[model samples]
Target: RRKAKRGQPPKPTPPPPVPPIEADEQVFAARLRGALYFFSSAKNRNAFLAHPARYANAPPPTSFLPPTAALLGPEAQALPLARTLSRKLGLVVLSLDEAVKWVLQGASPLAEILRPIVESGTPVSPLHQVQALQLRVSSPDTLRRGWLLLGAPVDGKIAEIMRVCSVLPSRIFGICAQHADASIAGLEAALKEKRLSHRLAKIDSSRNPLAQQHEVERVLLPLLRLRQQAVAATAEGEAHTAEGLEVTDDDFVAKLNPKFGFYCPVTWLNERRLHHCGDGEAAVAKRCAAEYKGVYVCCASDKQLSAMLLRPEEVLAGPPLPSPLPTKETQQAAAYGVSPSLWAELSGHCPVTLARGPKLGDYASRALALKEGKKEFCVEYESKRYVMASAECMEEFLATPWKFSRLTLPSKLLPASDPLDVGELPTRGYSEQTLGDSLKAALTDLLTLERPKYPTLSCTETALKFVALHLKANNPNVRAPHLKHKYSSKLHDYTERCGLLDAIMRTARSNGEVAAHSTASAATDATEERDQGRPGPEGSEPDQTTATAAHSESAACKKASEAPMPDLATLFKAWDEAVAAGLDIH
Candidate 1:
């Protein structure tokens, strides 16, 4: 090789650093087809369309200023607005309806296939739609100027069309919401008669109405999707490729499904109305076009209407609720019911054990009320009107009800065979290998012998207290935590071993239930709110007869209240008298 001359050549400096190859001036055209090859001028465009393969290796055209001009709206707006958007925006508005009609008029081979489907409810397939759009937007000139795409990317096909195409609309210049749901009645009547197409065609307002360029400006300004900030940042910077974009169809579909879809014309009440759909009025107009016989249901709400009408396609996945079933501690004011928070609450543990009534030797698991005129007062410790009967002898019970109110009772118990089950007798349990037999013997000896002793006092007050005191005095070791009564250590050992606590409570609740039933009618008139521990109905005292009977009952109650503790033998004699008098006893 000869050495380079110093001044003449200077080694050519690597050919001025090879400039990057620019893409051909255009890659797409409007209403023209050439094997995806772009041309710079009309001469080159025609040359390429004539024989696309001759330029098979045509360098990809550099990205044109993206089609910043977008024309999207519902089908309703598309019919009237497409012509206007054409003149106003100076965009070659490719209305899908016009395109389909144009194709069918020429009876292109693809249009021949699309005609029947297009005439019927079904849209031309996504592929066919893309191809048709390709023919329109493929021209080299159209790609650079960026013509407006009007209403082909309808519901259920937007993503497929967008991803399959080599480009996307960079700017959304306008959105129009046709107030169709608001005027549903007219559409419904037209649809019901199947004369909607005829009526729409006949409508003078739709055909040659005064063009309100003002209307376009008004609607476009308020409904422009991108804010000023968003507009300042153009998406043109994104690299353009002749290759189709790859995206998961599912993600696109899911994001778009809720935002845009075909709504039935039928109303929520199922009235005859075609539901308007799509984001733009223009898009909605396309669907409503007579060429497409598709049916749609009305959207469920204004949100659905507005979102499909004007909202941009954005994903909004809401958070889920914690549970299907919610608990209620307090009733809402809307319920028009008493607040659950204000209502009386009950503890699960038995109220019988927490009551102080037992300490006074007056043990009953229920509260009996004494009626005086209109109001009733509880005889239990304090003013607690629950299932507790008072021990007239115990003052300690009034101070603390929770400590001794709860009562637990044995279940599945059988009564004793002998009539003298409650008599003071030491019935022994026989040990047995079988669990059932052993438990049975133990319960029987306990329940029949020392538990639920025969009533001994002449008065109800004396008898009830005496039984409570007797058991506690006899049984000491075991702590009946619910029972406020103190037991003697030595005297109560046998009582504790018998496990007769349940039997005693069982008998007490039984007698209380019986007493409740006997006077339930009178108590019904007292107050239903008594169950809520509220005061009885305010009213005049019962008539003279009621007052007389109450007086007599009061006298008996007073006498019982004043009675002293009676001997066990005297108490048993009183029980014998009650038995002879045909009163039930167990």
Candidate 2:
């Protein structure tokens, strides 16, 4: 290279050319179908390269997707599907009916027009319906994570209205029953007319509801993966900035031991005054008396060791070591009956009782229950000891170990006597595992050997009764043949010693069924009247009498049918009372 002239700077050297297929040093990249692909690690890269043909034309990985989605079809099919999705995914469910109710609760003029139609179960006009939906979608909570729209209209005009209102879902699904209905057909036509066929998918409600969930999940897997990526990225970004300040003794004050320090407020510290209290304890006391205010002085060997400032506001006004210390460990131990050592040892474990509750799938509840696990009632499964509340719970575990185990065991390891056989459990179909675990937990709690146990009945007999009642009330379609066979002798005993059996049977008929029956009866009455004779007139005495009787009948039918299924709170209360009384639950 030639030297530059005295006054001029030498020309800079050009950087080397980067390879077209270059990737991060930490990332592995490979060529596939003349295009470069990246993997998180060498193992992933190798796996991809092993089957390049399978991934050559694959869609590019997406990093983020909004959670907005719409479910259109019959209310019977769509509402349940929306609720299931809300539970499985963290999406909020927003139904058109709920929106209309919200609108009616507000001062909007449309509420008056929509009220009669809503009460009569007639669909509101598309324009007014979309307007209500728009209000709900614009809410901060719904906009933050998005919502799963239920019972959305399938008319093209409604879709256009939603689009214009900026509340249209990113994805639209038509929930169809085993036999397609006119509404489902209308949804398909709307999708085609809107040129949104690519965004439309159909979920069949005829199959097991869980199976239907699986189909929806399969379609949403890509979007779910994108959401996961976005969440991870956000967490990583926050990790760098969310570090707490390093605490030090200077940040707090102490009355007795310096180690046990209380936080000092910054405002108090800023407002504090400094004074030299002489060199001795006597002098410091004199100075404190003269000040006529609370003062903190550093002392050593009954002498003033430091001239540090003191703030009356900063000094805690109560006696040291107050009656109840404000510490989480102490509060948690007292509330949950857990020792510190036990908490430390089994902080990660889940108790059999709480784990079997309806909220078994909640992480917070699981963590809390872990501390409540009793050492006396425990069982070893796959070399891990799990704590149970009672012997009945342990037996339930033995009967269905897979249901309680945190680890997902392989089919080969499952017991042969499992009520829900491992082979029969759906894989990637739905959250049946969670449902089964909750059911078993509820049964175990009710059948524990503690007082309130069914009088003169074995644990097996008690469990059979509870299971039969629960299934018949909540899931009438589900058949427990094994339970039926095992408890055949005790099945006929419906003695209402505890009143639970009566309550369950009373709630078996749902309000919807009652309403449908009344509607059918009214239609039959109308047809008979038309065929027999015309009503004398609108305000005739005969017509008025007939209408009054029909109204009374409908009202009575609704009142009788309004008894809902026994919720968790009611069941637990009844269980406790029966156990205390030692009465027959069936």
Candidate 3:
């Protein structure tokens, strides 16, 4: 039955203009047929198509024809059936669309066959609709096969075919070079002769440093694939090979499976700043295009990145030279085209520090607010937060929350003394781990104060006093307690070990000093009753109770000195005090 049609069969896309069936085209076509014949597994058209250009002459073929006749003959002339037949013996014949389908279906053929047809007569692309073209040609024998796809027009029919065939393999998989002005007409003729077929996927031009240098992504997709066979063949020969790059960091390489490359702003920008020269705009634009290839980073603030780019010495020597500021339009473009969250991740990690919040006059500040502040939002996943403005989030937002967050909670809490070792993150949560470690370090510093035992109260109170000293020395807001009752309670915990308190009261009593005005009130209170052995006024009982109080305080201090303190919380009442006191204790 015919499939229901919602629209007219796509208007026939005209074939690209043919190059004068040159010696180059003929050689390229012959080599392509050779590859289709050689590696023609029904399931591996793309793998076959992507065989390297360098391998064009490898492993002598089963059949051979004089290069001139087989390649240069007219389309209507009797063909080189022997060479084509060699492909049939090598593998099974499958339609271009069915090639990928066979791979997906896991169909393996005992033999491979080549079916070359010119689809220039097939009306698939329409002039009005701007459709992407992908070209996949299974011919490792010719370097020009890769060039044809690259040369196909962006707007022309040949370009569309190349765009659709982006998934197809080429002779050179890992590194490629292409010309921007090659005609679509030539590509159409090649297609009409069944030299190329549509692969129907986007080519990633991101990895080829030369793709943008040559302006290929605009006209065509450039890709770098790791051919296992090529890599294995060249592994023993060269440290780095023309066949394929060795996977140096397998873990890192795994992250780029579907995508061919990744952008690391830190290394990329660092390298750029060392070499780049010119005004800030030109330098940044040039460097961004050169290094990051239009990827946006959200981790580093513009000011921080600018400082990294321009350096402090450069900033000071000039009269505050203007830098490349991401325009509101650029930020908007990044938010729309790039992963906003990933951009944030990159920007946040950038080597600059800026004051938090928004500003009115600065363009970058305003741009940041528009694209990443108010426009940005968060979603909860696996009990943690993830930025929504990311490419992964956009693709997997509703599909899988747990997988997106990539959270793996430890089964047990680590001892406060032991540092927790978190592995490299799968997402943008590095700052969270860093902050936690900093907090723990601060707390540990506060706890170490108890080692040099004082004849003071429990070591816990000594820790508190250390904390109090820190608060007084650094932060301005902390002050003496408001309530006398609270102060007495805070000090009571320390009185027993501080033997100086007994001496303090004796001195105060001998001098007839006012109890309220004395410098050592806390000390005096601890030992006054022990020295005097007396009660209070005629009508009231004394503030100091019995000998039992002294005994209890002594025991508590001794016990504290023996055991390791767990946290600043066990010593100080607040977190602010622990950080302030961490230094004092040390």
Identify the leading candidate in terms of TM-score.
2
lDDT of 1 at 79: 48
lDDT assessment of candidate 3: 0.32
Indicate whether candidate 2 or candidate 3 has the larger TM-score.
2
What is candidate 1's CA lDDT for residue 273?
28
Question: In candidate 2, which residue ranges exceed 4 Å CA deviation?
Answer: 1-66, 74-76, 107-123, 177-182, 227-586
Put down candidate 3 lDDT per residue, 35-138, tens digits, no spaces.
Answer: 33333233333343355343545685322211100111122211222234224223122223433333333223311211111123333233211121111123
lDDT of 1 by residue, 387-454 (tens): 22222212222323334434333332223223344334444421233234535544454445544332
The lDDT per prediction is 0.39, 0.53, 0.32
| Candidate 2 lDDT | 0.53
How do the candidates rank by TM-score, highest first? 2, 1, 3
**TM-scores, all models, native as reference:** 0.24, 0.27, 0.19
Error of 2 at 148 (Å): 1.5
Q: Which residue runs of candidate 1 sit more than 4 Å off their true CA positions? A: 1-4, 7-40, 43-84, 101-112, 115-211, 221-586
RMSD (Å) of each candidate, 1 decimal: 30.6, 36.7, 29.5
Pairs of residues at least 3 apart in sequence or in different chains that clash in candidate 2? 356-441, 452-579, 452-580
lDDT for model 1, please. Answer: 0.39
As a TM-score, model 2 comes out at: 0.27
Candidate 3, residue 207: lDDT: 38
